[model samples]
Target: MDIKSPLPFETSDKAHANLFNRMVNTLVENDNVLSQQIEGITNETLFILKGDQAIQDGSVSGEEYPIGITFMDIGQANDTGYPTRYGFVKNEKISNFRFVQYYYGTGNEAGNYFDSTGIWCRHWWTGSGWTDWHKLSGFLHTNIGTTGKQLLTKAEYQKVLFNRKIKDSHNNFDIKNNRFICPENGMYSVNAGVYIESFQRYANFELSIYLNGIRYKNIAHHRQRPESPSDTGILNTGLYGAANVPANKGDYLEIYIYANYEGDVSRYVSDKSGWFNYFDIMEIGGRNFPRV
Candidate 1:
């Protein structure tokens, strides 16, 4: 990328007026690229202008840089121009770089194993760095009951699997406390799955995310279904849902369920490790806006 000189302008004094006027002509240059024209001046009213916004791609001005596969920061340009760099975004402020791409890789001490989950990126402090794998919190598990005959009260709502089972990776969730306390303030993606089964009467349940003692995201609900009068326990239903929510530090995240039935109901639970149920949490971006 070719970076044009962003000359400093000074017009108050005769010595600085000539140099300032010459730099002003470059401001309106038709070259393509988003330009940040800021000059270091002692005056209170500082003028920082941007070039044409409708600039097209592949323009020489560097306005509207295209980011496809990967990108990185290299910092400010020099006097002659931008220095040659590889893979990274040249002649730009590293502070402005937003998205960071990541690739999936897996290996164990016993054997080398890898499966393609595709490339993913985050606007947060995420990257392809190996250590970033554990930086984000995520988990998966199911809410199964103790006895098949005792669950989902006929007229009442019951928290599935005794609040929530610690199935997948705990991440930021406190297994003992049975709640996910956010470690940072930002936007996050949450998902859940529920399984309902009835031995005799139809199955009925309501799943949701109870945040800060207040019911937040509603996942799934089974109103009424065919009942096995002979108590065969064959009728079953699966509920899955996902949603995005804004959260702040100290906010609590917990899975809740209200099951109602006549005979028996259970939502697939397991005491052993490695449950099929899934509950995932990912931080996307933070709240940042221009202060006008």
Candidate 2:
């Protein structure tokens, strides 16, 4: 560490005992290279580890090692403070994974558990053992605000209450039951939309995509007519769609709206600057469950 103590050994110059035996062998080779890099970081790379030091170093229930590189301060070990995590567990033949990666060290974010700072969670020893922290990044985008029209009916389908929440990283958007609740199992990537105010002539309009409540996906279907029998004028339309849905963990998603012109149709609140009626979900891909 910037070592330099050899200058004091000049007994009276005659190469001063061979420069004081090469400055005591360069201080015993820099003390054996700083004790083998501090014993490979305190015994094989555990540099600053501690969440009880993974069961005090035995490597969590020990089935055969594999638990180093941990760093936790969870507010000084569960004083219930929060922030500071960095883990990595592993363990095979019985599964056990871990992962973790946290931050948000200070400035007291004030919470009720939804500030994952740099978020990346994981956990997996299943059969009832360790399976809670599962946020591997899922997202949501919502929109809804209708103070006027909304009367659909080809005899059913009507659950598009998006309710407003733009960008939910892992809260899974459940604005009081206007659902989206899927937080694991993956493959999501849905995008939906709606905004039609009146189009009744041959009128068709349909936009669906609901999973836990069944109607799986009809994305959008619009059919308007007017340029024929002396048009009556009242036609505005918008329908959007995107899919890829596969979801699982508590699966729940919804967005419905039917039509065949059963009266009034959509546009309850537009002009609040924009966004007709939306719902975007995201989780791109992840699997390993009963999704075939």
Candidate 3:
């Protein structure tokens, strides 16, 4: 059988002829024709098998996975730009992509891991580098040392969870009745007259109560309060806003109310009663209150 040379033919030099002759002589002397054929067949078979396996595994050649990108800061860009030295995957489709920044630092100076704060991605290709691209500001992460705005207090959260109400002694008025009615879950109300001394500062506030641990399923907002005193009125409105509240049995309720306040009130209020004068609880359609 005639053996074909693996090396390309080059007429430029006599060294090529010497190398070809040496290869042919070696093949004949060693009787390597069958071995070479088997080796070639095995490699071809393996290549085909591996190619199928790679396709199944979502592997692509000349593709850069976003996981390979590294971020040095926590700053986020809104429809801004890409980070330095980061590029998109070539010849690939992307969806439901997001970028988030992780905060890492101790004291005054904190660094971010990436740009944006939530999952965001776009189908893109990078032949050279990330340039002249459009990226929306997804989310922003604050450094761990940066003071987070007050979200909610344990007691306030509990009050919303328990759906407690404040009653006026003079009228025996179930002030809880006057506040917002959590239609599906139950009713959660607080008196406008009560004050949490610890959270003295104020800003636009939003109260989110999870009934049965549904999570952000039901949220209430009370915007633009003046100070502690203003929060009282806002709380009252939040409780009695005529909105359908979340209700469920064996449900864990987590209430997160974001507010601009001065200090941490976690240690301040012990229970729902600390923030309100009259603490009462009642189901929206039910008459009796659970004995506590």
Extract clashing residue pairs from model 2: 146-268, 146-269, 147-268
Query: Runs in model 2 with CA error above 4 Å?
Result: 1-13, 20-24, 36-48, 51-70, 73-176, 179-190, 194-238, 241-279, 283-292
Error of 1 at 24 (Å): 23
Report lDDT per candidate. 0.45, 0.56, 0.32
Runs of candidate 1 with Cα error greater than 4 angstroms are: 1-154, 161-171, 264-275, 288-292
Q: Which candidate should be chosen as best, given TM-score against the real structure?
A: 1
Candidate 1 global TM-score: 0.43
lDDT tens digits, residue span 134-238, model 2: 334323333433344455546466786666676665466777877888755556878887776664356777887889998887877887666552224566678
Name the candidate, 1 or 2, with the larger lDDT value: 2
**Alpha carbon deviation, residue 26, candidate 3 (Å):** 99
Deviation from native of the Cα of residue 44 in model 3, angstroms: 89
lDDT of 1 by residue, 95-147 (tens): 33453333221222133111111122233222321112122222222232222
Please give the clash total of every predicted structure, in order. 8, 3, 25
